[model samples]
Structures are given as structure tokens and as C-alpha cells.
Target: MTEESDSPMTDTDSTTTGPLVPEDITADSPFTLPGFFAALAEGRLVAARCTECDTHLLPPRPACYGCGSRAVTLSEQPRTGEVISYTSVNRPPSAFDHLAPITVAVVELDSSARLTGRVDASLEDVTIGDRVELQVRDPETVDIDPDFGLSYEEEWPIHVFELI
Candidate 1:
């Protein structure tokens, strides 16, 4: 087989732009969640873009799910997006009871990458097509219970959205 092929299984082109081996996927690489969150904490949103298919992978991985290609590269994502769908969670898990009636939305960013996150608005205030901007918060700033599966040392960044 050559470098290019129409069949997904036969597409063996190695556009491998980023890490190509396990030893290269360090915490400093955006290909991992730790690295992804690290960038978020620094006020930057990053994703993996497949060179072969233009698929954007949030919380980036090494391979492209779209064309089964391993030629993914780090990409900075946009903070603004529109609300594609939303809902209110009146009954949340016990650990998140303090945040009852949480409003969540699946936002499609300007790059067409979609991610689900809490919206800093009441259910009644949010609607389809509403413009919003991403907000990254230190986990401690939020009222999540300590036992919410995250340890103090591993304080993860919380992603949310606010109407623009």
C-alpha cells in the first residue's frame, strides 16, 4: 500500500506530526488530559486537529477517530460558541447537591468543536443559538464537595460558559 488510499483501513500515510510513541506522550504534551487541563489553567484552550481529516479532538488524543490516522497536531481552540442544546439538572449526584438546578449546555465553538459544560445562567435564560464565551475556573473557586472524586492535590480546572 502507498502513503495515500481511499479505504480507511488502507490509509497508511504517516503524517505523524506530534508524538509517535508512548515515551513521547508526557504531561507537557497536549495529547493528554493533564496537559490539556494544564493549558486550560493557563487560560488557553487546546485540541488535537487531524491533518488527514480535519477532525478536532477535544482533550486531544494521538489518533484521529475520523480517518483512523495518527497524524494529529495540537490546535488552540476558540473561546466563543453558540448553545446548540441545553438542559437543567435539578437532581444532580449527591456530591454535587450543593449545585442543584445546574444548567448545562453543549456548545459548538467557532471551530465547530463541541463540548458540554455548565452555563452560568438559569435554565430560563439560556436558549438555542445563544452566544457564549468559555470561562476557566480554579476548582477551589467552585462549591463542589471535597469528595467529588477530585483530590486537593489534583485540583482540576472547571470549564463553564457565560452569555456573551
Candidate 2:
């Protein structure tokens, strides 16, 4: 009788091969926040795509929220998207007060994944359906106060949207 592959149970299948095992969820794996930020810092945007229901999970989780399936795989996301909604934060939190009147928006990426981010334009310059591209910047390069980041988030990259 064939021993069904003879691999250890602790092994996690490749991202596109099968369900995500507990062994696959690690700080160095894209399924976790640290891993997600690490990939973002490297100029790669990654998300979790559920094989069972085709749901995309940003800041990727191990399980598929759409179908409660663990058969999720890593998917690279497109930088271009359309603005779905927007608003201006006239009174942002104290940590972001220095950049008040910030224009933010919900963008639906070309991959159908959506995420909210700060827009480079002013509130008056933005409108629904505007084309935008994601921009990545080092945390220190952004204008926000240095203290705004938590100790653990000091190295995470910040993302913004630029009108296209």
C-alpha cells in the first residue's frame, strides 16, 4: 500500500497547494501582520484569497471569513484602484493632529480587494470613482509625528493613494 505522500503532519502546504495549516501562521509568514508588513516594506502587496469562496482578505488571515475555510492562498494585489468613498478628517486624533484635514478614502483595488488609506489630494480635489494608485513610504518619511507609531510599528511601511 502507498503511504499517502509520507510527509510530516507539521508541514504546511504551499500557499497555492492546499489549506493553511497552523504551522503556516507565523510572524515570518504573510498570513500574519509582521509578515504582511515585511512584504509591504519590500514593495509587494499581498492578500489572502479564499479558494472556497474567492474572498480576499487584506492583512491576510489564516482562515477565509467568507466561507470559514482554511484553504486560503497568498495573492499579490494591484496598486491601482478606484475610489469608492471618501471623507476629510478635520479633527483627527492627537497623534495625527499635525496632519489634520486629511483626505482619506475607501479604494477598491483592481483585484476587487478594498482598503482605506490617506489620499495625497485635498478633500475638494477628490471624488468618487477617481483613479488612484497606492504609494508606499517609509514610516519616517511621512509627515506624521514620530510618536504616532507604536513601539512595535516603528518599521512598518505607510501607504497612501495618489490620483492617477
Could you tell me how far off, in angstroms, the CA of residue 159 lies in candidate 1 after the best superposition? 0.6
Model 2, 1-164: lDDT tens digits are 11222221121225553334667567888788898899999988888877788888897787878888877778878788889999999999887887888999999887777899999999999999888888999999887888888888999999999998
* Per-residue error (Å), model 1, residue 4: 34
- The segments of candidate 1 whose C-alpha lies over 4 angstroms from its true place after superposition are 1-16
Clashes of 1: 0
Worst lDDT run of 10 residues, candidate 1, spans 1-10
lDDT of 2 at 31: 80
As for model 1, its CA RMSD to the true structure in angstroms is 8.3
Off by over 4 Å in 2: 1-14, 17-20
